[model samples]
Target: MPVLSLAPRRSGFGTELLTQTVPYQLRGTTTLTFKPGGLQCTIELPAKELLQ
Candidate 1:
C-alpha cells in the first residue's frame, strides 16, 4: 500500500497560503489480487496530470 499526502490552498488579504491538510481524489479503479509472493498493488494517475 502507498500513502499519499495533500495540502489545501488558502487565500486572503492579498496573500495565498497552503493549508496543512487537503483532500485527495482517486482517479482510477482499485483491484486487489493474491500472488505467490504476497499482494500486488497498482495505482493510476489522473488525466489532468498527463496533460502537463
Candidate 2:
C-alpha cells in the first residue's frame, strides 16, 4: 500500500494552496493452490492492467 499527497506551491506574488489525493488502482487475478508438501501461489495480470 502507498499514499500520495499534494503540497501547495509558492510563487513570487502569492502562495497557491492546493490539496488533493489520488489512490492507486489494482487489476489482476490471484490464485492459491495447496500441495502435499507446500503451498503455491500464482498471479495473472493483463497487458493494460496498470495503465490507469
The 0-to-1 C-alpha lDDT of every candidate, in the order given, reads 0.38, 0.38
Query: Which portions of model 1 show Cα errors greater than 4 Å?
Result: 1-24, 49-52
Off by over 4 Å in 2: 1-25
lDDT at 19, model 1:
18
Model 1 — which ten-residue stretch has the worst lDDT? 14-23
Q: Compute each candidate's TM-score over C-alphas.
A: 0.35, 0.42
Summarize candidate 1's per-residue lDDT along 1-52 as a digit string, tens digits: 5433332143443221111111134344444344555545444556785576
The per-candidate count of clashes, in order, stands at 0, 0
